[model samples]
Target: MKAMTFKAFAVVNEIDLNKIAIHCGIPKKFTWEEPLILKGAILESILGREINAGQMVLIFSFGSVVFINQTEPSETTILLKFIQRFEPDVEINNADRYTDDYKLHIHENESLELADEYVMVPEFEEFYPELISTVLAKSVALEKTEEQLGKIHDRLETMIDRLEKGKLRIGNKELARTTAKILRHEYNTLAYIMILDKPEITWSSSTASEFYDKMMEFFELSDRYKILKSKTEILYNIMDGFSTISHSIRGLFVEWVIVLLILFEIVLTLLQIAGLLP
Candidate 1:
């Protein structure tokens, strides 16, 4: 029997976990343990297949849903359609296929070279969704961060143009405030992806760790992680610059107020000396 695995992922903002469980028709007892991983048997009919071929649905709190099936890649189409039935507002969708071979003696990296071929293992099936989900979540996070950066760049460009023309007004300050808020939200999203949403190492299982490490390398996850880190740092620097500029503007306004007060006092003293004021 030729075993094959197909994985599909969808990026969403937030999925009500309980709602999804209920929507999938998972029994309340089975869901109480780990609501994230839903077995295929419970959804087989709804998914329109005998998931005994191997199926698992993993939902991440970071807003990613991964469906893994050990059947033909074509079979996944129905599953994907079924998921979309519940979640109509998916932001991004991606799919990957791998053929499983038991006879082939393939190293982890070599398996990647085959591209869509993988060595069959029970542990791999258990952990595969986490790997795929991590990658998908990271991709989504990067996309979101880049979008925020783009908006900040646009606003910054406008602010720079106004400043160059010596027409920086109260609106500029408001823009800076808005940008800061966006930056904060973006930073939080990045943190969630990098820290909270990452896949944890299964210390007890060295095989699982090796698989994760190899797969991460195969996916160039480290490189992507570095890029995300660099982008986050750039955003932090920009936010810092905004803060400095805001403080400088406030200082300038304070100085003008102080000078005006001083001039008013001098005028009042002169009027009193001239017997023109009480």
Candidate 2:
């Protein structure tokens, strides 16, 4: 069986594909829906590696790059450094922190089979790399988002603990910051990463569509996205509850201040009536 390995990384918020294309002097071949394909001599020159047959790199605008049949960690490090030129804020460390690996095997007389572990195909098509990269890129992106959500969840739990102890304290500024963080995450995952949207290629080709569906199921992408949405809603409700409590606390404090000022005025009036004040 002829096999190839694929690795994908979600390293940054986004990549400047136009800038990279300008730098490479390669004509812009990528769109928001399609990833830029690098193969043959130019890819070799970029990676500073030998040109192996069937080796390719796919760069996505959503801050993901898939390395097909390129296994070396040093190769990834080198390419990410090059990529950092286009996106100065690109954190190379995330390449390791958020990544997914998949394998493709071509077997004679075998039908296309996709599973969480690997995919087996009768023959590789020109579109296989793009399709596979799409799945891998989103999968790793989801992984990163999942990690982020986990952190938020843990923080909420900490707040809950404080509440249980009757010591919950959060300022309006902190609440605003937290709300913005959650909203940003929701927008990034839904609008930016677009895990729910179908790839454009899949719309034109039924076979590709079928393959993409199978790959999505294999990765459980939709289900995970739903879970993320549900978690977001729960967090929202929690924050809403906190907001209500905060407002109520502030209102009570204001009322107490008003009552104390009234009492002070009454006391002064009583003293004046008794000739205790000039």
Candidate 3:
């Protein structure tokens, strides 16, 4: 499961006061419904604690002991206000949690009872994995795209150097073409972001299509290969034309110099014969 952290607020509701009073040393005056901000030392206590994205954080803290069920990490208003005192950098955005994201969990249960898996029912059996895999693939595709782009950039630079040094050559035009075609396959992967806006993505399934769309916004920043291919071609064409023009100009200049020298020799010999020079 993807893991990410976000601010959360929680408040126990309808506490059994008598039970808490007998077992706990703290004052039992506060009912279970009392709102407590989940911030400050408590937040720092659970920092880097992994929780499932979009799940609720079940904090079971009493006395000095904290037990956390980080599987479904969400928060009530109390937890949000509590964490505010610690002054986290980001505010409470009610952000969407895509696959592979986490939320922090804090409680005073003392014992380490980490929830490795999620609390899932039969309803989510199919939709969950498919959606998760889709986003995960997109994330992977994004990383791969960046790496390929770097290689492409290096190739372009090398091609430019070859052009400048009079060694313009395509090492394997067919190979490059094949790779470029594969990169085009990434367009389908990249288009996953737009699948939310388009109906085709959901036509075959259900769920309003929220999670993937959320991460896609961030993914868009890293998505440049689509545009790069077209632009690289244009740049190659430009360099090719420039090289041809330069070669033609160099030939013309050499021809002009030769003609001028020949004319000068003819005139010099004629003048000598005519006694115009000593």
- Candidate with top lDDT is 2
Q: Any residue pairs clashing in model 1, and if so which?
A: none
Taking the tens digit of each residue's C-alpha lDDT, what string does model 3 give over 1-278? 23323222212111233433343243445432221222333343344443333432322111111112233333333343333333342133531221233232333433322232222222323333333333333343344444545565566566567668986444445335534644553443244222233223445644525433444444453345356446556545644554565567677879999999999999999999999987
TM-score between model 1 and native: 0.66
Give the per-residue lDDT of model 1 (tens digit) for 1-278: 33434343435444556666677665553221122666756666656666664466666554555555545556456655655566665543443321112121224433333233444443234555555545544454445555556676676667667767876453565756866766565554555445322355446567657765665565565676676567667766765666676678888999999999999999999999999998
Return the TM-score for each candidate structure.
0.66, 0.92, 0.33
Clashes of each: 0, 0, 32
**Best candidate per TM-score, number?**
2
Stretches of model 1 off by over 4 angstroms after superposition: 1-3, 22-35, 45-52, 70-151, 170-189, 195-201
Which segments of candidate 3 are over 4 A away from where they belong?
Answer: 1-125, 165-201, 204-206, 221-278
Candidate 2, 1-278: lDDT as tens digits: 46888999988868778778877778765667677778888788888768678888888888888999885778888888988988888788757888888898888799988777689999877677788899899888888788888888888888788888996567889889888889978976766778878888889999889988989888899999999999999999999998988888889989999999999999999999999986
> Which of the two, 1 or 3, has more lDDT?
1
Q: What are the lDDT figures for the candidates, one per model? A: 0.55, 0.84, 0.39
